[model samples]
Target: MHIDQAILDKVNPWLEATFDNETHRAIEQMMTTSPKELEESFYKNLEFGTGGMRGIMGVGTNRINKYTLGKSTQGVSDYMKKAFPGKHLSVAIAFDCRHNSKSLARVVADVFSANGIQVYLFSDLRPTPELSFAVRHLKCQAGIVLTASHNPPEYNGYKVYWEDGGQLVPPQDKEIIDVIEALDYSEIKFTANESLIKYIDKEVDAAFIESTVKHASFNTPQADKDDMSIVFTSLHGTSITVLPDTLKKAGYNNVHIVPEQAVPDGDFPTVKSPNPEEPEALTMALSLADKLNADIVVGTDPDADRLGVAVRDNNNRMVLLNGNQTMVLMTHFLLEKWRKAGKLNGKQFIGSTIVSTPMLMELATAYGVQCKLGLTGFKWIAKMIKDFPELQFIGGGEESFGYMVGDHVRDKDAVAATLLICEVAAQAKASGSSVYQELEKLYVDYGFYKEALLSLTKKGIEGAQEIKQMMIDQRVNPIREIDGNRVVMVEDYQSSTAKNLLTGEVENLDIPKSDVLIYYTEDGAKIAARPSGTEPKIKFYVSVNAAIDSIDDIPSAEKQLDEKVKAIIRDLNIN
Candidate 1:
């Protein structure tokens, strides 16, 4: 492969004396022997998306290496100085079980301290939610976490959070990106100011665990807790650090861990992908649950910000629940609890993403609590919590296995979610019902909402362009029908407009602009197309719903919705 001049221009800087000898040797080897690999690594700089940056870890501008992380930290430091001039700025840092996470965290703290900023660094690996809590608890100006969420082992990431304990949004994100793009390799300060760095542990852990426990709403007797057998797996991530203790503190004794995946290994040896959303990732946990005859099985991602759950069905077989199902179960349980406790005064609301099942909105409406829709990421949900000061944020979640219980932690919290979910399971057991039975009751009361997600990954530079073109095609040439259902409305988030094709009218959508498109069918099906901000892929989300008259009708209704999703995918030619 021929290396373009632009790629060479980006790679030349690493050959300088400023970069370490190890990095230089790696780059030299790639350039000499692997021109194709060299081009992919140095073609362009890694993007600093709305939340933060993520990429393959290597020795290039496009990778998550020491130099790229240093530059990002320096840019953040510069922005902090400008954003809060003449003030003592401080930041907190945490890392997950990913490879080089601890070392990269130290490097990031070094950059922040070198910039004359105080740093509160975690003494050991911690979950992402704890990092968010530490930011507000310590009264720091910002926070950073080093983990790739659920990506493959070869990948890593840096997530930035503001004082509100939420990821960066709007003007702040753009401002930080501007500074990062303008920085040269020489501008990053790699030296450490040891005096300005403080190692924090135990105290923060106690506070975070306590806050998580307070979110539990279980009123079951001690006997119920003993009978409710729970199985959990961390997928070799940070959840193992806190979940067991949290569950134990919440009065659950019959808890078992999938020993194969309990150890925090960066390689994630037990699973192909450490994502709980994937069924294969939870295989070990489900097998263990089957052997132990456990009541419930839960799994969290690497950063412990997302959770996936499985429960025994009527046939007494362990079955995995989709992200939407988990969200629905949690939301319904909390809303009912609050209503019974007389906590619903019309000042409470739940949050969800637009791509999630609309059943959440219906549930909130039935309970007389507002439901707000954000974009794809949980950061938007956190931002909604900050935007609405008067309204109480009961809980919020997305369809990608991420959720938040209360306002304690601004980001999606798997630790708190896992504990509360177990409590819900226990409560159901006490009432002589199972989780699956409760879900059937919900569908019988409200409706059956089925959702499916299809992600198409395109690798490298050419793949990125292909994904962009796919989005463009969908935006410009909107589909008229799907599965014989006429498309009634189309929402183009990038243009901030919703067009009623049947009525020939246009209305404004009150939300931030993003490159996403949604189509609403006359039969109440919704299809959304959006590209991934952090990964090289385009995702399509399909949701179809039908009214269920009784629990016996669930199988047919589910089959119908499944067929509708398949038809929609076929109409869009997504395959």
Candidate 2:
């Protein structure tokens, strides 16, 4: 196949510019021997997505490499200087266990240092959320973490955080992109000011762990903790740096770490994907739990921001709880803690996403604590905290296995979330209830909600267009019904509007605009369609629920909800 001239136009500069000889040869090799890859590599420049700029690490402008990330850092540096003038600009830098993450982080630090900004670079790998904490803790102007979260081994990423310790949001993200677009590759500052670069690890780690323990630990007695065995696996990521130590400090005795997956490795050799959302990722942890007859099993993604939990059910079988289930569980436990202490005075609120189980709102309502909904990513939840200064942020989570316990870290934090979940399990067991049983009780009280996610992976160039067309098709020809249930309303987040199918009335949606759509069924079923911001796929979220009579009726109710989700998916005809 011939390489498109448009693609060649984007590629030629790498060969002729001030780039090194190695870069030129790599581009030349791709042009001659790998036309398809060359096309995908040079089709367009990588831009900030839902999480931030993330892609497979390689040589092209579209890839995550020294030059590409350097350019992004340059843009951020420029934007930071403009955003905060006459102040000494500084940034905190951290990286996960991804290949070349350490080096990539150094490059980012160099760019910021060369721009006369102070750089506080971690000497070793750290979880993504700690980077958020370090930003605010160290009093830096901004922060950057080099990680792709749960993406496969080939991927690495650059996530920017503002001074508030949250991921970069609207105006700043757009402004930085605009600055990056107008720059040439040669304009990236590659020189480092050694005097301005400081290597920090132990002090910040201590502060972060201390804060995490104080916020996440609710005084579950050491004897109560000792009564249960807990198993944890980091999935070959950065959580190993803090989770075990924090748990130990919090007085948990019987914690076992998956031997093979405990150490941080960029290859993520044990699992097919490092994502904790996938059940297969926790297989080793579950096996270890069974061997030890552990009460709970938990595993974190590569970046340690998202976590998956497994708890023993009424039948003594270990079961994996979906993201929604975990979210509701954690939120309920936190709310209960607050209620017992008389902290839920209606001035505190928790956060959930549009695709999360609606049971979170119900649980919040039971305590009279407000629950705010945001778009997909945790960045918006962070924005909610900043948006509502009058209200206190108790906790927030999404359907993708990410949760933040309080306003400390500002993003989805597994370091603290790990402790929070373990505490919930410990406390429940102390009360003769299990996490699984408490979940059923929540269903009994607030209603039973079941959720499933379908991700259709579309590869390279054509896949991008296909995903785009899929969302377009969803809007142009909206879902009207599913398995005899009538569609009562259609929500188009891209247009920031909701149309009532029954009354034909359109009302504006009060959220940031994005390329997403949701259909509400008459029976209260909701299905949302959204394209993956950082990956090459479109995702469909299915949620169905019904009131349960008692805890024993959970199995039957969930079976019905499962079939309802399947029928809805089938009626939508989404493959």
Candidate 3:
């Protein structure tokens, strides 16, 4: 095997005395026996993206381990100190049910404490949203959670949040990355300051659940809850910690949990992948729901920040709702309730990603509320909330099964979403309908919107280059038409430009610069292409909609939209 000298130079540092003996032994074994693995692991340092660092767990610069985490923590600590000089600096830390998560949380706490930053660390595994809440509730400057979210078992990650309870954005994200890049392993403070590190659990948990319950809109009578049967699965993650209790507190009684996945296991033994977005992840929950004849089934990812749902359709069969469908249901429900409660003023607004269906904008307009569009990621949604402090942020969601209710927790929160969705089910039952019926009614009132996401994974170092090249090709030779429909407008978020091919006019887009391209067809079809910031994959989001004249027209309208999406995909030659 041929090894690049630059890779070898990067690997030599792991053998130094500064690294632990276990790290040294792993590096030595890889160097002698696995040249290919060694090259992949040492070719470059794991980057701290807009959120934070994530990678496979191993002993290499490219892997996520103690040294890498230490450097990241030290750098965040340094930035916090410099940013808030002469102020009491502190951070909250949380972990999920993944390998080495607890230990990594402790390591993070120790590093923060060693740097004289007060650390409020969870005593055990907790969900990601609670960490964001703790950052605000504890009056800390930043927060960190150790989990790779829905990634495979071999993967782990570190997500950073700022004082506003959102992930780092813009200048802050770039500044933190600069500090992290300047850091060396030896510069990391590893010693633990026991006095500065505080362990918190029950108190914070109680506050978070209270906030979740309080923010939930329960317009239906308590008797409605008795008729709603809900089945929930955490997918061997952290939702088991608080979801059940939250449901009970929210006046739910007929709730059944998928016992097999209730346990917080790091391996996620029951599913091929513990992502709620994938139907396979919710298989056991759906099966159990069928057995119990439940009304709704909910599954959350390992970190419990995102939620996937399966609702009983009109045919009395369990069907998985896509992220866009679920978001529409939740947003519509919230907006309706707010209007009935006389809470919908012009100052209220809702948010959704640009990749999400445009139905949310229609709903917002119907309610006399403003609709805001951000780039992908909940952090951007959270940034929207931060930017418009004068407006009431009722709720917001993305197409990837993530929704945030209220601004109590600034990230996508499954706990609150789970509770609110159950409430929706109860309200539907009371109104002589089901969740599916309500969704169809929404389509009839608005238009029928269908959305599909295709992610093509490119693995390893070579795959990274391929993904970049694919984006470049799309930009250089743009697609002017899709499925015989002329492309009306082209948006390049990276350059913050939007061009109308029909009118031959160009204008600047007032959104953050990101490497994303979107095309709007003459018939209202939309397609967006963006590479995954955290994974080695590129995603294509397609949305198509048609008017539904009545409840009977929903099925045909849905079919037409589905066919349009397929046609768009075929035109782009996207597999």
Candidate 4:
């Protein structure tokens, strides 16, 4: 079954002739020195998956490089031509502060321009959401952002967006992938039509800032901006250029930026990873907060689509709130403000992914606003907006600190989240209450919901097979209990069906088939399992909730939730 060495030798010469000089050199170097590495890299081509191409930057087929980027762009350009022939094609391009990000963006721009597509390229780094916004704002046919989001510093990515400002879905994604698979080294166009590429910076920046600031309900609630000291960090990426000014414009004069992490550097020298989801990345901000007695510490990842916030607890120590908790607070705060502004019409609705805490649905139901649940990705939320024209999507978020406030953009927007969170904090401060106190009030009003996410990464070729087998095992024999709670239902997104464990009945699920499963308990506790789309990880999402009558029960209630999670992990045999 093994291929002959003679065939490989023959194919190697073809590869050298086909690839560009840099790519050929990289491939030759790896093949001569690290044969195993070369095979792992070039055995299979870089694929356009659910979120497009993302991987570590290196010289291999599996890694991201100018050649790979050019190939993907060429495929997309070719598809655009066939999909919309005899029409003027336009695509917007943006990037983050990752290594070689600007260079990659320019390469992509050149490829598109060479294909005779008009390009709207950002002159400087911008957030991912702004790229989504720009696609719609400029009426372009499609868009691209050079960012790996909250991934580690060694990684970079390229995300594609359609004219609707959402990532391509269904048929388009499949068609694009097919076209990319059919392409070879010769198919990629490297020549640049400089005249066709337009560099845009200040115009979009001003527009995005204006739109984000308008989302703020109460800008200046406190008279003394100096009293509310805040420390902010960009984690050595984008957001420094506008975030500080945005805070100042929102009437916060005493905001401090983390000096070591302020400048836009791709190396991310101050932190091991650029992800704001991890506490280590936010260490600089938290340290500054502790030293300066700041009210809040905020950090945004490289592309600024996700946010991390730390608030002072009763013990006067900074506590980093998880994604679920932050989303809950923002949902509560925004709904209240909208209701007070007489903006909560009957058509107003809020949304979150199925894996998010059910607290938002409970709260929205109480507020007379509809709570719509979508699949994990923000594109599904965008799909909902397209499907339901009557209902206005107020906000949507995942448990990963990504949130979107309005329909202006189709992706998770950290800028809007930043504006809203600060406004919420300012209002709480003006009322002489802490943000934690507001969270406690929400818990009391809408039941205490505590959720935890456990992600197990299985690396390399063998790891992928292991993850696949695990999914098969779970589907065949489902977990029936967690801490003695009776299992009520099992929602398998992959099958697009919900199984009634007791009654042995099945019902159809409305969403598309995805490799995700959720087990619901009779008492409302839930556990969800899914393999990550981008990384080599299988994630477990656990949620446990109880009704709280008073603030004093927070300790016991939290303990119970913790025990439930631990028990579930034990029963599930997760490593």
Candidate 5:
């Protein structure tokens, strides 16, 4: 394959720069031996996306490397100097157990310190949520965490956080990107200010755990907590740093840590992928739960922002609960607790994404609380807390296995979320009901909603074009019917408009524009299509619900809903 001239133009600069000799040699070697790799590496500059600026580690403008991160940090420093305007600016830096995460974090610290910014660097690896807490706790202007979340080992990311302890949003994010792109690589400040850099460990860790225990631990009796058994695995990521401790402090004593998967390893040797959402990643934990007769099983992704859970069903079978199920269970428990305390005033609210199950809305309405929906990231949910200061933010989560309990930690915190879910399980177990039974009760109260995710990965330039075309094709010719349900409306986030297909009216959607489309059927079914901002893939979110007259109707109702989803998938031709 021939390398495009535009790509080559982006590549040639790194070869003749203040770039180190080793990087120079690698670039030249790629040029001679691997043209495809060379072109891919230099095709574009890394920019902020759904998960912030992330790419494979290598020597190029498009990759995550010392020079790229240094340049970005230098840009952040410049922006902070202007945004804060002469105040003593500081940033907290944290990393996960990913390969080279520590070194990359140190490199980031060096650039910030070199720019005369005060830096509080973690003494060792820590989860991403703790960094969010640290950002607020330290009263710093910004924070950075070196984590790719649950992505493969070949991937790593640099996610930036604002003073609110959430990822950068709107004007700030756009401005930061403008500043970074406008600067040259040589402008990066790499020399460290040793006096300005301080390493922190136990102080923040203690505060984070304490805060989690306080907020996540409902009043589950000590006897029930002690009797409830839990099997947990960190999935070779950073949760081992805090989850076990948080669970222990929250009164859960019968906790079994999966031995083989407990250590922090970036390679993730024990599983095919480190994502807790995927069932295979929790194989060892599930087995341990079976052996120990654990009441609930939990596993966390790398950096610990997302968690996967398992519980006993009505038939006493250990079934894994999807993200939507977990969201419903947790949100119900939270709202019910607040109501018992007489805290469900009108000003309180819970948050979720458009892709999540609509049952959250049911629960919110039942509690007389607002259910605010955002596009597909926890950062937006975090933004809601800042956007409306008067409203009490109880809890928020998405279908991606990430959740935020209260507003103490602004980001999706699996650490705290784990404890909250365990509280739900333990309390239910104590009440002579299992998590699955409680869910059936919710289905009986609210409507039964089941959600599914279908992702199609397309790599390289050809793949990118195909993914783009898929969205374009849908816009040109939309689906009108699925499983006998007529399409009533189509919401296009890219244009911030919703078209009523039945009434032939177009209304505006009040949210930020993104390349997402959702079709609402005349019935209660909803399906959405969107391309992944971080990965080279497109995702389709499908939600189908059924009516169960009673708990006994659950088995047949579930089968009917599954068939409906299958027919919808067949109609979409998503394969």
Candidate 6:
């Protein structure tokens, strides 16, 4: 056997003493027959990081399975008990359309119920954001959603949320990690009190969808009903359960679903990855749009939180909008609608991650609203809402596809995004324009901001070391220039300092410390680098902008700006 002695010492006892007969047999077989696989699987226990637990679904300590799920639930239950003793501790649970997701939800519910915690589990698959909403709506102490988001079919995940209907932050995250580490497999109790495990379905769904629609900018969809033709793809995930109905209820009559990708299938047989952020995931829907000459193409990931869109540019070529472009359009559309309706209350606020395009702040300033800087996640944006009740959180988003409009849900919601995107398209069409036209208008009003993302995936133990080394190298030897543009400022998020290269003066960043480095050029180009929290990858986000005076200059300006961005990327030597 090629098993490492240290790994065997840890896993052998776990199989013999801590697990059941089926798990024990599985481990024994791997140890004897697939020792290399066993060694890799059991070399180290899965680390529950800030992003919660995510891994391939299988029978191993390193993979996501019944034992790991139970242990995580038990640990969370213990923390809830300690934090809110004598209170009726409750949690809302939702699952995506992943393999064994429902079964894993049952296991999680059983653990919580056995621990005397109240569990409000959805009877069918639901989007992840609704779980965040349900936590606070039900006044639960914490929440869990079983989803891998946009991961491949072989993967599953568990996301932990707090009472505020957001992912755990700071002390609570560390506290939960401590409790989870303290639990041995022996401490997990899977026996369930079925009476305490409640099944929630239509009631919650109706309420959530109603609240989501209320976030829409259009009060009456009849005004531009004929102007929009939207093609939506759920990518065989949870959105098909409710998103189609939500759009209909929002008064969008001409909505079509990509037939093959509309069903809830764990295999996700259509796309390589269920992530809508990738253009390939929207291939079928975009093709249909081109054939029908539709107005727009919209897609959601498996868990239905993030959204991606496609539209025709002035050249009549169908193109996908990047995350930053999408956010810019959504923000401009929402605020414009509000202003027209005279709904721009004095205390309205919006938010985006620090790494996101600064153009959001500029656009918000034009509207006389505040654009607060959130740390990397939506949780921080949610935290902003909780901290400042006086300021209404109008919308917030990251450079990634995830976006949240209104605060009914603490997490990003594709249901709301899809409905609003359709409405935005309809409204633009009513004004004798397309969504592409509206985007050009936004660029004319604000500036033309072009952004691109490069993600490099590294796997296994050695892969992690390499990613860490890359970060260290960048920190030690920061870039001084890119594409003939002088690097004027360097923001080291790990140190929480922004250094002005010209002045050699460092100012502390007001956000929390993270392992990110951002480089700003003299000509208004911003580049940010950070490691992914949930996956073995590091991502570089490049944003550049040019001022546009009119819509006619969009094509040539876009071409020139794109060249600058590409040159910057090439100069940085980012793979």
lDDT of 3 by residue, 45-110 (tens): 888653468899998989999999999899999999999999999999999999999999999999
- List residue ranges in candidate 2 displaced over 4 A: none
User: What is the Cα-based lDDT of residue 93 in candidate 1?
Assistant: 100
Q: Quick one: RMSD of model 6?
A: 1.7
| Predicted candidate 1, C-alpha RMSD | 1.1
Each candidate's clash count: 0, 0, 0, 0, 0, 0
lDDT of 5 by residue, 114-228 (tens): 9999999998999999999999999999999998888889889999999989999998999998999899988998999999999999999999999999989888899989978
Error of 1 at 387 (Å): 0.8
lDDT of 4 by residue, 1-575 (tens): 24447435533743666666776776667667766666556556666654567888987667888878888899899999998889899999999998899999999999999999999999989888889989988999999999887777778899999989988887788899888878886778899999999999888877777777777546465574557788899888788867787777767788989999988988888888888889899998998899999999889988888899899887889999988888889888878877988988789888889888989889888889998887787777777787789987788788988888888888888878887787777778778888888998888888999898889999766787899999999989888876678889999999899999899999999987889999999988889998887777899999989999998999999998888888878878887
lDDT of 1 by residue, 1-575 (tens): 56788888888889999899999899889988998889889888888663479999999988998899999999999999999999999999999999999999999999999999999999999999999999999999999999888989999999999999999998799889999999988999888999999999899999999989888645767888999999999999998888898888878889999998989999999889999989999998998998999999999999999999999999999999998998999999999889999999999999999899999989998999999999988899999988999999999999999889988899999999998888889989888999999999999998999999999999998999999888888877889988898999999999999999999999999989999999999999999998898888889999999998999999999888888888888888874
Global lDDT of each candidate: 0.92, 0.92, 0.91, 0.84, 0.91, 0.86
* Model 5 spans > 4 angstroms off: none
List runs of model 3 lying over 4 Å from the truth.
none
Which 10-residue window of candidate 6 scores lowest in summed lDDT? 43-52
RMSD of 4: 2.2
CA lDDT, candidate 1, residue 426: 92
Measured with C-alpha atoms, the lDDT of residue 148 in candidate 6 is 86
Taking all chains together, each candidate's TM-score versus the true structure is 0.98, 0.99, 0.98, 0.95, 0.99, 0.96
In terms of lDDT, the poorest run of 10 residues in model 2 is 473-482
Candidate 5's displacement at residue 65, Å, is 0.7
Model 6: per-residue lDDT, tens digit, 222-296?
857756778889999999988888887777778888999888999989888889889999999998898888889
Output the lDDT of residue 73, model 6.
Answer: 91
Q: Estimate, for each residue in 1-575, the C-alpha lDDT of model 2 and write its tens digit.
A: 68888888888889876798889998989988999888888888887888888999888988999999999999999999999999999999999999999999999999999999999999999999999999999999899999999998899999999999999998888888999998898999899999999999999989999999999999898889999799999999999998898988888879999999988898989999998899999999999999999999999998889999999988899999989999899998899889999887889999999988888888887999899999999999999999999999999999999999999999999989999999999999999999998988889999999888999999888899999999888777887877899999999999999999999999999999999898889999998999999899899999888998898798888789889988988888887
Residue 187's lDDT in candidate 3 = 97
